[model samples]
Structure formats: structure tokens, C-alpha cells
Target: MKTDQEIMQNIRTAIDDCTKGIDDAPSLQYQIARKAKGEEPVVKKISTTIVLVAALLAITAVAFAATNGIGITAFLSRIIGGWNVNENAIVAPVVKENTSKWLNLTGTEAYWAEDGLSVVLKVDSADDEHVVCYSNEDGLLDETGERGEQIAINGEMAPLDQWRGEKELIIAEFSPLGEGWNWYKRTDDGLFVIVTFSTPDAEALQKGTDVAFQIQDTNIQTGETEECSVTLALPAMTMQEGHK
Candidate 1:
């Protein structure tokens, strides 16, 4: 059996490997703008997005280590301490709800700290089997089969490209944060995804900002693609205290 330290070391290594070439990660602004303008964007695998969160988590760990000097174990505890076995347990105090005919966004929990913002989304769909895909200017790329999707923020079509010049707001990371089976499992009833957005300006994000979260899915038999989105009105920022 692996010791706790050993496991953490392994995680660190995985994070390093996953984030090694983040410069190559798809450009968020360019792709989204291309699609908005009716152009086809480059193809990127879904794993790229998933690995992104891993990289962000790794970055979060590093930031915590720099401040607390405790270590990764303690950092992990501090970040996920609110997680409950039931999954539905209310973790963050600021929660919201949005639903559509095809997609049911059951719950959204968000928190903001000195470093950045963390969001957890609980989604349910009516389709028996849905293919989650990423949209580029060219068209939809199946996450399970083709691999990549355009990134969005606060329902606005703006891409990271536009903000590259702005030094104040930096999108350190944005991707689905999942673990074990939750990472790969796709079900009709309940699907949970964790998304983390890091920036130097946590204050701006925490002060009741409006941001859009978007996801695209395709029906297998019908060959119809649907775009679903939720606009979240985030409340004021709060420091991450002890586990909720």
C-alpha cells in the first residue's frame, strides 16, 4: 500500500505531467470567437480540458504551499473538506438553480477565495444517452469520440484571446474537476462537474458577477445537437474558512 505522502507525491507527478505543455492547450478566445463568427476552430481532445483542471488543482496546491508551508495533503484537505459522501450535500453557501426542457441544472455551488473561484455543478438530462461535445468554428467535436469543445465564460461569447493583453484578470484554469468514476461516468439522471476559475482578481469575481456556463450535447440516434447554458449571479466573495 502507498503511504499518504507517497500518494501525494504521485498526484504531484501526475499534475506536472498533465500541465507540462499547457501553452499548447487550446486558445479559449480564438476558438469561441471563431464559432461565434461561423468559422471552424481547430480540433482538441476532451482529455485536454480534463487535464486542464488537474493542472489547476496542481497550481492551487502550489499556491497553498507557498502561503501555508504545510504541504499538499493539508491543501487538499482544505479545498475538498466540504465534500460529503452524499454528493448532494450543500457544500458552498452560495447556491443557484437553472433548468431547461432538455437539461436540468439541479444545483450550483460556488466559493471565492484570495486565489480564485471554485464551482460545482450538478446536472441532469432527459436523454437516455447523450454525447457531450465541444463546439468549434468548424462544428461539434464529440468529447468521448472526437475530443474538444469551445470554452465560455458568463454566457458571453468573449474568449481569452481578448483578455490576453489585460494583466489584471488572468484565467489560470477552467475545466471539469472530477475524480475516479465521477470523472468518466456519464449517466442520464445525475452528472456532476467541478469547475475552477483562478485569477489574481478574486475580488471582482466575488462581488456578485454574472457569468455564463455553457455545455453542448448531441443525441446519438437523432443526430441533433443542443446547446445548454446557465447564467450564474455569483454573490459577494468570501474567504474560504474551514470545511463547511
Candidate 2:
């Protein structure tokens, strides 16, 4: 293949010689001879009329779609990530909220304590579920305290390492079963933070927990000091009987 320099030289000669009269016809023919010699001539100019017509058509199409609120931008994003977001997929908004409610100490209680990490919550019903959500630099680190990739939430594929270099957060929704805790982390900030809730059946609960985190709006500021309550539903079997 000819390098860029050789191609430009040929084009320059062809254009410069295009103005030559019949007296220079032989030279003009010689300039473009390289094109037949396996050197692809460069195209510097396209028909402006055709380009303008196409541009106008595109503008009209986009304007029509905008007026009707029909677009493929979101659908395209999901398909690229191996996600099939149903046109009717349910979307639950993750709102930053604050609640004064507390778990009743006397209610069924499940304690999560593994060596140094411990968390406690009272179990009453699915309504008693709570998810502890906070973003920290250490969040990027695995339970072993070593840096690790974030897990999936709702069967979403693994995130490209390139996109996970920043701060991350997960919402650990603890149910009554209380033994093995499963959690989902939202990689992207948005109104509908997709998740796969645990089911009562063993098979359903055992479905490896995690999903892809889609970025919604990173503009959702953190550390605002405005605490919020998040509700997560879970199956009763997820909680196990434990000491009070």
C-alpha cells in the first residue's frame, strides 16, 4: 500500500494538471496513471448537493422523532451490553431518601459477623428489609481488602476495567434468611437501578447474585448528608432462624 505522502502527491498532480489544455493532455494522463498502477487515488471532494440533501433528510427525521419522543438511543445502549431491556420492563427509581424508622430489637433478628465485619438487623417481614448503600474509596476493594472488580447486579455482564477506575458503591439488601447475604451494586446512577431480587425457593435464591451496573446520572451528588431509606424485597427462606 502506498503511504499517505505518495497518495497526496498523486492527487496534487492530478488536480494541478486538470487545468492543463490539450497541449498538456499527455501530462494529465501521466499524473493519474499511478491510479491504474495499483495506487488508489484519494477523493478530496464529494458532491456537495448530495451531501446537503442527505443532511436535510436526516434533520427532518430527527426533528420528527423528537416531537414524538421516539428514539433508539437507550435501546442501543442495552443491546451493546448484552442486555435485553423489555419495552415494558419495570423500572424502580432509586431515590435518595431519609427515614427515622429502626428495626425492632425484639423482632426476629439476624446478625452478620464475619471475623471483623459485622452488621445487625431485625427481621420481621420483607418490609423490614434494608439496604446499606454508601460509596467509599475502599468499596473498590474486595472482602479480602484487595482491589477487585465489582460484581454484577441483575445478571448484567462484567464491566470493562476501563470504566471502573472511579469510586463505586453497592446496596446490600439484607433479608430475613440472615445466613448468606446477597447484594447488588449500581455501577451507573439513575432513576431505575435494575436488580434481581432474591426468591423464596432455594434455586431462586442461589442464582448467583449480581448484575451489570449502568451509569444513570453521575451528577447525583454523594455526601449530601441527606440520608434516605431504600426498600428491597426478598423471600422468607433467605432469612434463617438465629439467636435473638
Give Cα-based local distance difference scores for all models.
Answer: 0.44, 0.31
Give me the displacement of residue 203 in model 2, in angstroms: 21
Write candidate 2's Cα lDDT for 1-244 as tens digits. Answer: 9999999999989987886676645565664776677575755667997687556645655554466453433222222222222223212222222142322111111111111111112211112232223222212433343444543433354542433334333322333232332222233431111122223234432332211111111111132122224433222213222211
**Candidate 1 local lDDT, residue 161:** 29
**CA RMSD of all predictions:** 20.2, 21.9
Off by over 4 Å in 1: 1-100, 127-189, 241-244
Tens-digit lDDT string for candidate 1 (37-103): 8797566657875676667666766775687554343234334423212222224433343433455
Could you give me the TM-score of model 1 versus the true structure? Answer: 0.37
TM-scores for all candidates? 0.37, 0.22
